[model samples]
Target: METEDEAVQLPFVGSFDRRDGADALADKIIRTLSFDLQDFRRGQRPGAPKGFAYLRERVEAAGIFVLLIGNLGSHHSALNVELFRGFALADPVAPFVVINDQDSDTAWSFTLLHELAHIFLGQTGVSGSKAGTPVEIFCNDVAGRVLLPAAELARQYDLRDAPQAEVISRIAAIAANRQVSNSMVAYKLFREGLISHEMWAAVTSLYRQQWLQNRNAARVKENDRGPSYYVVRRHRLGDRLLKLSRRMLTEGALSPSKAAAILGVKPSNVYALTETAA
Candidate 1:
């Protein structure tokens, strides 16, 4: 698409009345008459890739390109996975949603929608773990609502002030069903007033600690297994970029090195990466 006007307008955003502020606007978007999330497929993937893929496809279909990157070995310190999650650019000509692939796939579900929230608002900026600013919270609220609707949660779970054990159990079930993190579920509960701020804090803190520990173990296992380079490249580059790169390469419109630059891989790897967008 050459301009934002040329891109396909998402069906859900068409119903916006524009009478409310950001937070209220978010609620309106979620309640769109055309809004239905049943197509967000539920899969048995050990991670959350299945959910992320379905959502990403929908986003790209609406004329935005999604990119994925990782913590560059030693350069991991530079990105600081603890602080940075992802960012979006609401460019009039080429809107882009770039996410850190290094973040857990489950977390990707929340982060992807969060960035999408930015694009819908025509807000261009970075997003991080700490959602302090109004824009960040708005984005967060949109993501949470989409993934775990307040009505659904309240209807399905007790959501009342309860023993820590019961709260933990409730959060886990929702997180697993919604393909999001427990922290996200807790935030939704807090936003819905079903839980106190103190309870939200406790739940989020508990999960953050557990996630870090699990991540450390998974990292060790990954090192032992040594990931497949082509698989990683194919995943990060995504289907839209891979297909475009392949077509351009066949047409001789794009050089191998240029493809590498665009795909964030070496020239030799571009061929394999473009060969399969799975």
Candidate 2:
């Protein structure tokens, strides 16, 4: 809520008021952002999609905060990983989205866009991948369309009549290239009518199984060394919030304790955190 008071309000540009066409909404959002988000690879020309860094910057520029938080294995130690993919709160003045950073990069990207869809629709909620509510399905469609457009998906990924191994190989490659998960790829194919529900189910289940295996291994490895304290703190607080804290402190508008409170750090740690963030 302090962030809301500090935020510069921006007008909401979404057109999803009781509308069923998620693709249309997604398209409009893309246009509003003035870039093709699917071309996530960094580009040479102006206004080209520049992957995750660029996306987060643009969302933040649009007056929305995008934060990456720890996952079940790291932060929420007792919960199942599959039960919490992301969270979103829609406010006209201070909409923000959070993605569990402990997930794979592919899952991170999908969850980022999924929560952005909820923000676009001006809704508040938490979600898991298997959520089947109408709102969740609609948000998934919007996110899927932005990441995997129908025409391009058809041309690049024709999974019909392929062998199981080949199908898995193709989807995995697509997921890596498109910066989306195998589950997202299968879901898009099913939504586009290129794959049957059975195919989608089998593919998603396999990916989920693989994810669990990977997550367990990652937990053991990541815990051994762990991320830098400064890096983790900087990411959780985000650049925008950190920058603001520093500016307010410099201007004598914010006290040390208040800055620490806002940044979720100790009073002494606040200076170090802000300097490292810079």
Candidate 3:
């Protein structure tokens, strides 16, 4: 990865409203980053999410990407005011990303892509209330397409002959393979006219309910000893930030106090922070 001082420069000076505009911008970004569909898929190993690391590396190369585990009571707790959010700054000097980490992996993935769309579209503001806005809609379109390509969906499931139940089953299978929530698959299928809006609503609601139940169960289990502080923090702060902080500390470019402050921990905890790259 490139050094922070050598991060790539991406300048956004205007806005766009058209879906075509969003698609065009998405294409430009993929080309600029030399990213392909395989890069997204290759990192997605079974039971392991490697894409976030890939995204984090690129963010370190070109911008700041923050994973704020708000509900856990860190400085990011302010984000709990909203159910979820991901923001991209418009200020050129402060170009950065802040994504809520207290969501399901699928939801978080979508939010990340949604914010990336905002960065590409130069759309900067609180994302909570802009749901139906053209910019938001455009970003949603971009995000959905990026995660689950329309062409791939069309080729995988035949809406003409497959029964609705079978189609839903196929959707779930595909979603599992892709490591995204089935809700996303339902949305894509609905958009493709392969499923009814009613079906989409029902399926999305069902998945959300399942996710809630699973989360509650996991929370109960987590209270018993779940992951260590640093392990969880690794995901919240991301590998790029943690590794960079450790490197600076080792090179004498940063003091223990400053490193701890940057990492939101006490100076005494600096050693623990650098002990593992997790």
Candidate 4:
């Protein structure tokens, strides 16, 4: 909820397209951020085998991250709020990002990476639509490059003339290895022209239905109470936001009331909220 005055002024004056060297800019930002995909593949760096913890750490370091606890339907799923630290209107380094929590894990992860690309590009706007605008395309390029690198896909499935069965099998194996959904893998393959459009559409539809079914089943099992309060809060706020708020609270730099405000909970609930995030 940063005011217009506090928003980061985009580095670009007008155009946000590949012609503007968006891809090169994205590559530079990735390198500068030190997001080592090779280390992630080796599982020798970052937090754990699953990579979300490491990604969260990098994201929090790059900017202020917030997870909005609400549905955005199939559109308007994520947003970025460019906030400048201090009152310096001239400063435009780091910004803020907010993402919807209603999407399935894979979709959520994709949106997260996409928004991070925006932050790196110094772009600001709501995300989540089927359009192929230049900025959207650029962000998608960045997200795909980082999350499901084309080179990795090439290494995983070297066969260029594989049968349908072999293609599906390879996609499933790669998705499992990457800890991402098969739909994501299929989409990337389609983009890479390694899979046919027909196959991609079929796989995407099947996975979408499967995800919806699983979500409905889980909701019925939970009786609509949803996840525990702390679990929800922890995920919504993320570890970095929680740890920073907790540290500020402990150091007396942030008042309990202010912490509560930032956390969207009562002052008395701040400690408990952060505890759940632990």
lDDT of each: 0.71, 0.71, 0.66, 0.61
The window of 10 residues in a row where model 2 has the poorest summed lDDT is 41-50
Candidate 4 collision pairs: none
Local accuracy of candidate 1 as per-residue lDDT tens digits, 66-170: 888756644344465566788888765557888886666678878888887777677777788667887788778778877776678657544565987888888
Tens-digit lDDT string for candidate 4 (1-278): 13223345445312234465645655754665577764444442222235555565665665545454443333254322222101111124335566554456555545666766666555667765533677776776777777777678676544356776787788778877565668778878887878777877777777777877997797678755556767766766677678767877776778899999988888998998886443
TM-score of each: 0.82, 0.84, 0.78, 0.72
Q: Which pairs, if any, clash in model 3?
A: none
Task: Write model 3 residue lDDT over 1-278, tens digit each, in one string.
Answer: 24346444556423343555756766665654455555665565333365655555555555555565556565445454244567766545445566766566666666767776776666676564667677776777777777777778767644545556876687778787564678778877877888777777777777777977997797677654566777776667766678778887787778899988878888998879777853
Model 3: per-residue Cα lDDT at residue 231: 70
Per-residue lDDT over 130-224 for candidate 2, one digit per residue giving the tens place of the 0 to 100 score:
58988888888878877777767767655666666777787777767565678788888778776777878888888878888987887777754
C-alpha lDDT of candidate 1 relative to the true structure: 0.71
Return the lDDT, model 1, position 42.
Answer: 72
Which runs of model 1 end up more than 4 angstroms from their true locations? 1-36, 41-48, 73-78, 156-161, 223-227
For model 4, the superposed segments whose C-alpha errors exceed 4 Å read 1-26, 38-49, 66-68, 71-94, 155-167, 223-228, 250-253, 275-278
